[model samples]
Target: MDIFERKPVNHAIHTSPSNDLRLVESAIPDIQPHECLIHVRATGICGSDVHFWKHGHIGDMVVTGDNGLGHESAGVVLKVGADVTKFKPGDRVALECGIPCSKPTCYFCRTGQYNACPDVVFFSTPPHHGTLRRYHAHPEAWLHHLPDNLSFEEGSLLEPLTVALAGIDRSGLRLADPIVICGAGPIGLVTLLAANAAGAEPIVITDLDEGRLAKAKELVPRVRPVKAALGEDAKGFAGRIVSELGQEAKLVMECTGVEASIHAGIYSARFGGSVFVIGVGKDMLTFPFMHLSSREIDLRFQYRYHDIYPKSISVAAAGLVDLKPLVSHRFQLEDGIKAFETASNPASKAIKVQIVDE
Candidate 1:
């Protein structure tokens, strides 16, 4: 071995049944010929992480044991297997959680859309562990080398930024497309950033929480923020958005999985426009099929992401968008339990809570 892998135990945070999370030590993972070991520097707590911690599963992936729970992460290279040439020890890199099977026979992989590969093993998604630990091992190809200008915190945020970029790309947004985003949370905020970068103008964002709406306006001053009133009908909500923007939106990005928000996005869109859904909602949603079909609205969906890390990193490096303000809270690895608690509850007003190595 070229590098001395001396650590015998790695302390990691895991989620168990009954909303339990604890810090425990386990043996450091071994690196394969094409893999590299990373000493985790920072990991961001995601909404999915909170869902898994509270319910022990997000749909079908249950936390049977002390399952790790994080995917948005960045760290330094600790060791690299013999065949790893892209990175070496002390290199800084951001981790991409999903490892898709790149076999040529797989249709998705054959078309360079590996994010849709059914055989992908994404971190923190059942049976597979995540990067919210002292050390992690990943295939070299999935990691993106971070520039010296990007801090570990900024690097951790690239995951969600890539998601936003992927959503915008999938939506096929055109220049100056009037867009409405249905939520002002992390995903929605990042989507706004992506839209603005893509030349989408006069964007409108909605959320029930006034604070989030305010934060959205603060982050992107040009974005028109609207607060969703309680029990507001889709038509009424859409009317408010249209009235605010002075015209019906050409693109509606549904970042909230709430069925009502989805409906609002549909109705807010202009005739023959598109509604891109980025949030993962229920398996089955009862939508206004007749209305959407009659209006000829294009309903699109964006999965996690595909081949966007490089572009996302490049954009972030170039200051095309400022993501640093999105990180609202921070906790050490040992205080991960508190991190989860804060993320689960909205009292902390946390847009993105990051966990740093102690």
Candidate 2:
């Protein structure tokens, strides 16, 4: 191998939702010239990872065969494509998982919505490998420049943060608008942070998990993190929110794709309020569309993200976002299995977990 060649490594991990994941040694990766080689320093375990690990699939994306399982990550540039610009070896950075697949002329891509580009290839899903290894080779355009002040773990979380930002942006939150965020997982808290920066009034987070909810409150005192504990009164809870908030929310961001959360967001919104949905739940659910439509509610589903990376990067680079509190756990490359196992558990002491390079 040439000294500059970004060769594949000897480590990888595979998983399913129902089965405990295992680490496997596989081909590392080789970099093409238009690509860059990243020595991954950190990788996050997203809810999607848990879904895949526990169920062996997420909707249509299945783990029937060999594949690595990670998407959010940061790393160091070990090599660069012959035509690569804006990055060089030794530049520490985060990896953007979505790559424009075969077609480059997609409407989503033409408009810089590469995240929604149907032609884009992504990591850790079926038919495409992920970044759960020591090294990965990817296109240069997808490698984001990380600011020196940010840790690799924070940089790795930029993907989910961007998603949260996009969801909030879609809702068009005004300074005084109220927010009801369903689900207090990493994505939910990221949304809370984004809403907080936007000056949205009183972000309310709902979740069944106490640990996750507690962590969210620690990050933002202004955030009203409420645990929808078992035996808790849903109607009473709704009424209290109305009493405390003064009115129905102008914006509802559903971070948990569960059916219950979806309904909660619907009823939580003020008549005609907009709800931006980024949560991925079961394919279908029974919803009160008649009531929603009667109220003229604008329920919009925000797919990944569109034309938001640069904006998100700027926010992080300029210090507008404090991401340190979001990452609750981390692991080195050698501890890949533990990382996956920890990430797979909802009760595990992690809001967001990462895999770091030694």
Task: Give the winner by TM-score.
Answer: 1
Kindly report the root-mean-square deviation of model 1 from the true structure over all alpha carbons.
Answer: 2.1
lDDT string for model 2 (287-355, tens) is 877978899999889877766777777887777778887877778777878876787666776788778
Q: Which stretches of candidate 1 lie over 4 Å from their true place?
A: 1-9
Q: Who wins the lDDT comparison?
A: 1
Q: Per-residue lDDT for 110-143 in model 1, tens only? A: 9988988989999998778889988899999999
- Of candidate 1, the 10-residue stretch with the lowest lDDT total is 1-10
Q: Give the lowest summed-lDDT range of ten residues in model 2.
A: 1-10
CA lDDT of 24 in candidate 2? 77
Candidate 2's C-alpha runs over 4 A off are 1-9, 16-20, 102-104, 231-236
Compute the lDDT of residue 188 as modeled in candidate 1: 96
Q: Estimate each model's TM-score.
A: 0.96, 0.92
